[model samples]
Target: MRALFCYFSATGNTKKCIDLYQNYLSLSGVESDIHNIDDGKLEFNPEDYDMVFFAYPIHGFNAPENVLKFAKTLKKCKEKKRLIILKTSGEHLRINNISSYSLIRILKRRNYYLTNEYHYIMPYDIIFRHTDLMAYNMYEALKGLVPLDVKDILDNKIVKLKYMPFGHLLQIFMLIEHPGAKINGLFMHTNKNCISCGLCEKACPTKNIEIDEKGKVHFKHSCLMCTRCAFYCPKDAIVFGLFNSWKVNGKYSFQMPKEEEVDKHKRYCKNSYNRYFKIAEERIKNQK
Candidate 1:
């Protein structure tokens, strides 16, 4: 059977999981097409695939806008397409994590059947660094989930690991209380170490970062809180915290590679550039 895997990821954890999951599909003899949720409508016809695997990170209480937009594209289709949502979150979503309720509702409205679903606890992709051992264990646990998910999907069984209204309630609380989505970029600043490299500006999905011709960095909002700009900054120049400039610890950056960081970036950059940053550029270009 033919399948499509469409995903949106900022810090690479979701992408890494998809990469590993692809092998499982291959072993099961399922033909699969993998695409990032970007660039308007995907090239393939939705009806052509037997099933669609929608993979993405759980941003706060919801899916990323890009992923939602992709789903929106298929809203009016009359085809009865099956869907499997593979969500990656940083421990908040132990299983399907009730936050998916909203997404499932949206898809249901669009008339798509969710045949299977699962979630993986990816390494902490935000905030402070995770301890090395903790990172390893989390990675291992997430990796282990991949095989089970693959088998379940191949068996045509629906898997719901957890279901509770409390998770949905937590989403509401986080939405009201978590300032990360509202003002994350507001506190970001470019320290003296920044080489005026435009990498962070390019990495951000939200176009919240602007680097002028002279390399002066500017932070403005509608931040996704994906922390791409902060972690991908080569110089550790972009920091998010109250009074960021005064922090004695200096700006924090992700030096810890998840295995050949530079190599993985090289392989994944072009795809991500096409997937996320290009959309941001187009939005700005259109605004002008």
Candidate 2:
């Protein structure tokens, strides 16, 4: 069978799992194509593929806005199309059972069948989120889940799914998390260590980072809070905190491409690239 594998990966973990899943598909002799959703060149008719495998990182216990938008983009797809969701997270327990529910709701809107779902406990790179040793242990534990997941998908099995706690609570939490996730970017500030290399600007999936005429980088409110900027900043200059405090910053290392090489995996976006920028702009304006 043919498949379309689309994913949004802040760090390489989700993409890494996607690659292995695709490799498994290849070994099974199934045909498939892959796309990075934020490439900003969204195009696909899920009706054309026998199955669609969507993978992404769980941000703040919910699917990123882009993923929701992608679901809307597939509105015209035929009904009963097979869909499988794969998420990668650091704390799978807190990935929020509602996260999967949110995705199921998205699929239901389009009348797509949720055939199977899975999540991987990949290494968490957020510095304050987890330590290097914890990440190593998590990676070691989660990596083994992939091979079996691949076999289940290939065999068209009704795979069991895992959910996080507090269904109603997480559903309500989403409302709060929505604004909190976006506003988190407002807390992102660059330090004196920033060389203005524009690394953070290019690495953003939402095009939330912009360089003004002063050649200084600004973080807009379109952020996904995936920590790509904090993880990729060359000098560790991107600091995110609460109440202007940096002590709680997460420190995790993620391999990043050079600024010029970012386009190979992601698209460069600015405030205008996001639909809520006007509101985000107003918020930023009022904050100052």
**RMSD values, in order shown:** 12.2, 13.7
Report the C-alpha lDDT of model 2 over 31-129, residue by residue, as the tens digit: 889888888665766787888888888766678778877766666465588889888875545334466676677777787778988766665555234
Off by over 4 Å in 1: 38-41, 92-96, 166-180, 241-288
Note the residue pairs that clash in candidate 1.
none
TM of each candidate vs. truth:
0.76, 0.78
TM-score of candidate 2 to 2 decimals: 0.78
The Cα local distance difference test for each model comes to 0.66, 0.68
Cα error, residue 144 of model 2, in Å, equals: 2.7
Q: Find the candidate with the highest TM-score and give its number.
A: 2
lDDT, candidate 1, 1-288, per-residue tens:
888888888778788888878888888898888887644558777677888788888776567656666776764448777878888775543423765666676687776678887776555565334444444554655556677768778888887646675776665565542355546557678778999879877777667788888879998866666666776777877666553432222222323445532222233224532333344344445544
Model 1 earns a TM-score of 0.76
Give every collision pair in model 2. Answer: 97-164, 125-252, 127-250, 127-251, 127-252, 128-250, 128-251, 207-269
